[model samples]
Target: MNIDTIELKQQQLTYPQLRKTQQYLMPARLTGNSGQPNGYDIYPVAPLGAGKIFTGFDTLADYIIKTKAVLIDGFGGVFWDKVQQQLQSCFNDKDLSVNWIYTETFLKPTGEIDALVKPFLGADDSVWGTKATFDLIDLFEPAIEQQVPDAKFDINIVIGTGAALAGWASPIIYLDVPKNEIQFRMRARSITNLGNAKVAEPFQMYKRFYFVDWVLLNQHKKNILNRIAVMADAQWPETINWMYQQDLEAGLDQLSRSVLRVRPWFEPGAWGGQWMKEHIDGLNKDVVNLAWSFELIVPENGLVFESDGNLLEVSFDTIMFSNNQHILGKHAARFGDEFPIRFDFLDTYKGGNLSIQCHPALNYIQENFGENITQDETYYILDCDDNANVYLGFQEDIDPSDFRLALEESQETGKAIDIEEYVQIHNAKKHDLFLIPNGTVHSAGAGNLVLEISATPYIFTFKMYDWVRLDLDGKPRPINIEHAFNNLDFSRKGDKVQQELISKPQVIESAPGYQLVHLPTHADHFYDVHRLEFDSSVTVNTDNTCHVLMLVEGQTILLQTADGTQKQFAYAETFVVPAAAGSYKLTNTGSGRAKVIKAFLK
Candidate 1:
């Protein structure tokens, strides 16, 4: 039955007015057990030595004055105007001889940059783009060296996103902002894409940032990690948190050998749901709905560290950049700094069905998108109503030409086609694992909370249909029938989908009050899944590979790492166990059996 025809009871539609008790939305790994858990500390700080960190702009300026010259390099979306004003004010009070050089002066013209990135930006409204091969250096003018003043001053400050390329042999202070904050700034029109002076529309701006700017900046950040003398959290406007590079590296090293949890962020969408808003505490209830929780999508998430109650958050990439080998272990050689696995939430509970979509094949993605990996994904139903369903694969008599014609006609006439006539629909149940390898057609229907496990290359969805609904901004979402047709696997239809796509659970190991069940993934996937069920406690070995896990069934569980460090995780909370963490133990803190779903690179 279609989503519109499905009858849901009134009780199924009513969400609990009270938030889920003891549901810890902001989970963090602490350096020690001395500090109390604070769900409100979004920017947790890792402790550092006494002389390593500088708090305010005044303190940062004092440290800068000690050196003759310094280059302040950072990511895009930074408030360069605020940085200039604050530092300039501090320097003037000290009567220091300062020559301030803003990197914007050396940027190539906007038209030149637009032309350079046009090939990668795709169409005006297209969501997908090939990864750019250009570097941060290419965005600057060839005569950047000449732009620097030859005369010497007491303190020469060169600052901006690409300030380090200004031909300065000075101490570099890198300012870092998380990806979520950057998107928020984009929505507020307070920042522009790299090398562009005026902010484009939010959606178009994000498209450019994801396809071009972020690609180049991430490479630049990785290149400069070793050279940065100081790392600053630039999310805040007036105040700043600066720490010595050595200390930041130390914190990363500590985390590589222990369990780590990347901070999760939530966003509202047109197909958003009330599950997260009602269950996840600390989330703002004023929004229309919380559709997706970026549980552990490392590309856009951040890792927060707490040091003496002060918090600092850095982009999750810094962890891989600093210690990929320790974090990924044997898989490090193949993936390098890229985290191969991703875990996120697709909350459609009491909302709408996700867009009927399919991802590109490995060869298609690598050739056309400049990506090393494709978006191979699986949906684990975390929770669902009685009538919840998942649309997967195709009908037995499906015809590609007819399907394409119907989709195109719908796009043209704004008419709804009977999607189930072509796509297979399966009843979704809690803990049902649905495998969606690259090129597989699939989508989570309404009234279900889905824990999406996949590879790291997200945002490559080739949508064929979107239920003929306008997006949150009252605009039609993009449809990619041609792209979907290029990748859709017609052979995965009828009974074959039920036999292959739906995983069968088999108990692999069991003991008194404990059982380990293997939820096998598709052969095309590079990762595997396991569900650990225990009433008291269970011990698991990392097996020299990283493990991404979530407490799916129970209310609370305590995780103890190999080094005897312990942390508590609540239901639906996601955390990572690095390869170097060795073995860990989980003890049920709440009553009843606790089940944790574990995903690791095979």
Candidate 2:
């Protein structure tokens, strides 16, 4: 099918109307007396009665004046100019003399930074970069110690990305911007990379940010998290909302031992679908199609906390930095600060097929990309049309060299090849689980809503073909034939696809009203999946591993943790029960049987 025909078909296809549930989009953990989850922009944090939270610049400036010296360190993409402007306005009439220090002044030269990051930024690839190992302090000059004045003014302030490196034993105010907001600012050309003075193209900038800037800044943030006196939400240009570090710690502690949900974000893509757009109530309907929902990708997601009526958000890593052992439990020793599992949605309903792709093997990823884990994925079909199909494995008589030549010719000549001749196709049905370990070729075909559960090191897909369609920007997506060729497992073809790649569900435990069915993942997978089908309620033990669950087959279910706190989750809503929670009970709140898919490290 051509692009125009696909577009017309997407517009004309009629979808089955599902019940619209608004709570799943912006799910939040209500702390203290907080009643509701704040809307999409602002999250809510309940007061812990520890350090005081400052709302406006005047109050923040008042707190600043009380201290002899203050350091403002934060994540990348913060509008430092706007921050300085607002603070200067707040301090204009004060009798105190202010001395300002910007950490950027002590940064290494641009050429030096570019050279330092060259190895991590792969050659001319807009989509990938190797994770860097350097710290934020390495980017700054050693003379930063001499920059801080010995003679203190009434108010001495140091601010910027690495301001904490100034070594001032002063109150630290950390400004945080969510990952989604950072990308928005990058797209608007309002923010540059950490040490750069000029903004580059959004795609290139994001590559650098992911591999270099964010890596270094997150380490810095983690190192100084305990020292921070206040955490500021600097997403707004003119105003700032901040909470006490002790309060944030309280929230993080609560999250570590309790059930929580990271806020999910949605994005549109060229091969996007109408499933999420029509079914998810709070999503913006103006977009052409919603392709992916970052359901529980903790690396890019944020946890929101509510206090009184005000809301504040911090990156998901903050929880890991604070309570890794509590959140991860037995897995903490191996994974450390990294949350090893990810769950997201791949919506191809009424859209196009995903690009034919395979992920790198564990050794290849570790040696080439410096990643600790590989992207071994599984596609659990949540919903699908009757004609839905999944492209997987390979044809029985596939020839590697001929397939490579055909792919290269398609890339050069813009001619489509018969993909089915070289690859295998399987009809997809709802609730069918397909294993896609590293080196397995697969794609979610059209008319399927796939819930992808996998390792956390995402963005390592090597696309072999893309059906000759241009992206939303009217540009061809990058093809990674060489990378795919190196990783693809030619042995996983023909009958082996059906015998091993397809998961078989078996009832492992059953009661009168509840049954726990094991959806056996591949032997290479480090995690396992179980489906809890209950007519009334079922209790589950954590078994000393974290549980990532989604309500897949029911309208709603109420989760009661061991701590006696209960929360309700709707269909397709993803939530996490920390390993410290011990055990939890799920009650089917709707009329039908509730099926919740739970993934835990095995």
Candidate 3:
């Protein structure tokens, strides 16, 4: 076919590939299951089939028509009505309908795999939302049989978690889209497979769409032309994913180019990419503008301990590159620079005592520590033993000498610090959140499980004491004895331990998650938190600027309208709701109450 002719029919035709066509014409051949008496055996399909297959379609319209878009409404997640309405508005043809399918009846996947949606036409359609989660190859194999029953396409859209890919064990299928799509899908798949085991971001795995763009579009195919781009303006995810892929392929050369062009610096101790300081000296400093910045902190690689301790994960600086790029492009549409979104993450793994230390006063950090010190931290306990305890602020007067003595003794004896003298201890539970402000003498006890969210750049850790855990090489880790001893604020001691309230948090007027009460200084960045209850919807205003919304309880839909355009965000398990999402409403449609937290810049 001529290029023009192919372009004309590309939309409707089964994507043209001579090799794929050959497989589509192959006969129904069963290899491993031939001897089975009955059809009760389950063949573990490859994630990406060993050989290519063909899909039958002649025109784009036919392709879309025969191609079903399965919407599996996972439990604990919500699909906004506005999103439905907006998505519906895009189609000028009135015949097309967006069907809302509830997959609640089928046994829900316990942890991560709460729901699964497969768009099946013909024979495959019956299985389309049949399971809470399923392997993409298995789901599509039958579809291929139904569509191109006589032939196979080299490329097939394999939908499922990363585990599903493993479940099928297919190897070497090239994904056409950006890496993040695969990452997101793999993330979702993992969660769904867990079923209902308190997995976070349950629906994230399925929301990502991966296709072989090279086979369809040219190398220079603009993202704006993608099907998803037609529906939503959030193209950064795809762009970022592509950049990540570029970095992977291009490596140091790309890094050099990035430095020369932007004079940018990566965060120190970065996890996925190179560390920050190593590349700082090579960056170009005379650029007209700096587009993005990433940041992170990594512990010494071989740090080890015999007793239980909390490991602190620091977000590398370059994180801003991702969060800011998205915000400037997406959030700026609604909340402008006035509302800068702050992104912070500490990928921590705890080992032993994180001294009973809290942040210094906000003013203290800003004035003494400099303008970029915002130390209010929120922890979503990631994993912890059943009886682990953390000593948050003190219950009563704790003599400085006594506290020091306790730490010294703990270090000397390799025992947990005597929290009884300085503070009361609360048994740490899984998924509980702790709001640790500056100046609060808190220590994360043994068996730590926490995801910390904080603001700004300053590591003012006035450690009270360390249980003298040795490093991996069997040497003792350093302790901040002088600093810890000097910074302990024994005044206004708080009730040592208090029960955590994880139930649908009480939402007040204009709050998104939890209200962390603390006064802020001029340079301090913070968000008023609110916990959203299921069934009960809340109307939020981004009067200040960008708000970072996290799903703490359940899934939520952040409906946004921009310049007469509206978008709905369903299955936002733990995704960020940009400040530009505008004056939107949050709804909880999951079986249980939705617990969403919103943090907006103030």
Candidate 4:
């Protein structure tokens, strides 16, 4: 992804100004005001096993009145009141009592678990080792098996909050929430400090553990959603659409075009960059640096569907739940219905460098993080200052034990380790493709806006060193030397690092109007990347596999499908074409040459 964008001297609109403009242009929101809710009509995004999804208050009430046990699992921050009220209505309908087994009942008092292992354990491990916190089987199974009493009720509903995965009940209802929304609720509602009952020295411990909890919660949600019969958007008091996989497939068949873009969520971080804050319209600039744009992490991403010009947003998982053959194709066994690739922004432009980190190996990640896949990432430099560089691998020949000791000592003492003595630094240029497979140590240096494309396991980074920098909250970030050591492949050091990890582009295919440059990925990588240089337009085959694209260099362009349906994209704007969408054309409607990067499962 080439990010050598000409700095436009256009007036910078304030967040409100951009928002007002966007609101005026956009149609009526599909969210808010549940007017004649068409939800529950199609849900679970796909079919679960062979059983039918029994929904509607009356239907559930009738089932519950006669049923033995049921389990409903979701994030606690989502609509507890609405859930309770609706369940009560169902019980009131037949004058039948119901059993509610909330997993919160079994939580250990606060401070019982020291989750403050690291302030920045990447995305996955930061959520604490939840397995060590509590035993799911021991705490929330008896009730699931009907051994525990149901408060003298006819039916039992076990509300498993990441406490248990295999609930002893048929048809688990999994409620999914975008991660940004969860954090938003965390701030709006001062309910952090979860699982902590006893007093502690620092209040920020809860906040520190919050990220880890978010990570763990998401892992549990994703895993549980896999076995669920029905999936619902957890946004309560709003139109939570019921998604069914079969319906999603049928729905796609009907649409001539599907604009695939997740509602991007922004957050300020200690090492947040200024590029997004300055360039991305409608973003609040008054806050600290803009660090992360949760572009398309499905478990943390929601999809917006337009119905009669009403933009209703649902979980992105629904797209996968649809189980469209075109999306995954031959990779269906590996990724199943879940989308396998993730596209996000890592802005270090005029900001601090990302923590030196490496992801766990495949089997190691599965065992430790509960993710079947690992994060094999690539940084396509989108926009960068002339003096930008990326840190990768280890320098020369350093003692692994000494490196570990230095990192541990840095964590103990506030003394910053000389990072260069350990990690290799490479100059970063616009469109430079840096491959970071699993167990590879890497960090994007300052002054570079990076388009981070990788496998869908967004979390699970084991941050080894943080340059002794404190987080925005004035707290020291985490350093997971132990976990990093376990995952780090020492072979990804010295000269071999450049030879193998850094991608070199070569013209793979070309024509009069277009040229495709292959940005060769590592052999272990299951995905491929390419740069499409086009003058007017270039057509490409989806080959029954989904494609994620970004207008890295162009000012603007149109992505048109075979049906002539067009969606305009601008500089740095990312979008996906589903496998079922088949063939599409990218028309470079912008001035000058347009450079776009396309990534898909290999």
How does each model score on lDDT?
A: 0.84, 0.84, 0.33, 0.65
State in Å the error of residue 20, model 4. 23
Candidate 4 lands at a TM-score of 0.72
How do the residues 156-261 of candidate 4 rate in per-residue lDDT, one tens digit apiece?
6766464344346456655655555545445444234345443232324333444455445544555554466545555434234344434434454433133366
Error of 4 at 344 (Å): 1.0
TM-score per candidate, in order? 0.92, 0.92, 0.40, 0.72
Query: In candidate 3, residue 197 scores what lDDT?
Result: 31
lDDT of 1 by residue, 1-602 (tens): 00111121222123222111111222212223444232222223445545555567898998898976888999988888888889889998988778888888888999999899999977776776788988888988877655554366778888898877876777899998878878877776878798887878888888889989899999999998888998888876657878888888988998888888887888888898999888864555667887888888899998876554345678999999989999999899999999999999999998999999999999999988889999999999999999999999999999999999999999999999999999999999999999999889999999999999999988899999999999987999889999999999999999999999999999999999999999999999999999999999999999899999999898888899989778777788888999999999999988899999999999
lDDT digits (tens) for residues 169-222 of candidate 2:
888999998787788778767788977889887789989999999899889898
- The reply for model 2, stretches above 4 Å from the true place, is 1-53, 149-152
Q: How many angstroms is residue 20 displaced in model 3 relative to the true structure, after the best TM-score fit?
A: 40
lDDT of 4: 0.65
Q: How accurate is candidate 1 locally (lDDT)?
A: 0.84
**1-602 per-residue lDDT for model 3 (tens digits):** 00122322332133222111111111112222222121111111111122122211122223223444321111111112322343334332435544332122232333323223322111221111111123433222233222211113212222221111222222211212222222332343422221233433322222222111111121112211121211111111111011112222222222111110111122211111111112222222222222122211111000000001111111111222223333333434443212233333222222344545656565554444333344656555544666666667566676777777777777667786456666767677754666565555676665553445455333455655554554333555445545555455565364423432122234244344323322221122254454454455565555524445544444344443332222223222223433333455665544455555555554
- Model 2 worst lDDT run, 10 consecutive residues: 14-23
lDDT of 2: 0.84
